[model samples]
Target: MPSSDDVYSQLKDCVSEITKIPRGEITLNDSLSGDYGYKDGPSRRSFAISLERCFKKHGMTIPKKLDRDKMEEAKKLKNVRDIVFTAFGV
Candidate 1:
């Protein structure tokens, strides 16, 4: 498994590049729609596309059925560290 730090770094880099959100502005608590100005929510198709791109860039597989339910879980994530840890099944 990848280290938590590695995962966090990957997620931070992915989210920043995909969302076009500034590094300083990106935070775990920020909502995709409310905080990130993604009115459609973080689980929206567009966000998924960006996530898919990230996975592709890392030579990772795009998870299927990453819908609202999964997105909600993802949104509840507290930080890039959490996201990376969970994503790698750590």
Candidate 2:
């Protein structure tokens, strides 16, 4: 299994690709939109969907609850680290 840090790195890349925000500019203190430049709901949804796809690609089976959990965190994650924790439990 990939370590949380690995997962975090992949997530950073994924978020960068989805949001068109530079990975170096995205801080752990940054919210997905307020800090990372997500323009709207569809953009945010794209990020979440990419995350689910990445997790699946890495051989992680997302529990159905985690889908709802991700959506909840989608609104509430205070920072990038929260997204990492929400996804990978680190």
Q: Which stretches of model 2 miss by more than 4 angstroms?
A: 36-46, 54-66, 75-90
Scanning candidate 2 in windows of ten residues, the lowest lDDT window is: 61-70
Give candidate 1's error at residue 25 in angstroms: 2.6
Span of 10 residues, lowest total lDDT, candidate 1: 75-84
Could you tell me the C-alpha RMSD of candidate 1 in Å? 3.5
- Give the TM-score (vs. native) of candidate 1: 0.63
lDDT of 2 by residue, 7-87 (tens): 677666666666677888755666655665554666666656666776667566433223433444464234434555555
Off by over 4 Å in 1: 41-45, 60-68, 72-85
- Cα error of candidate 1 at position 71, Å: 0.4
lDDT of 1: 0.58
Q: Which model scores highest in TM-score?
A: 1
C-alpha lDDT score of every prediction, in listed order: 0.58, 0.58
CA error at residue 17 for candidate 2, angstroms: 0.7
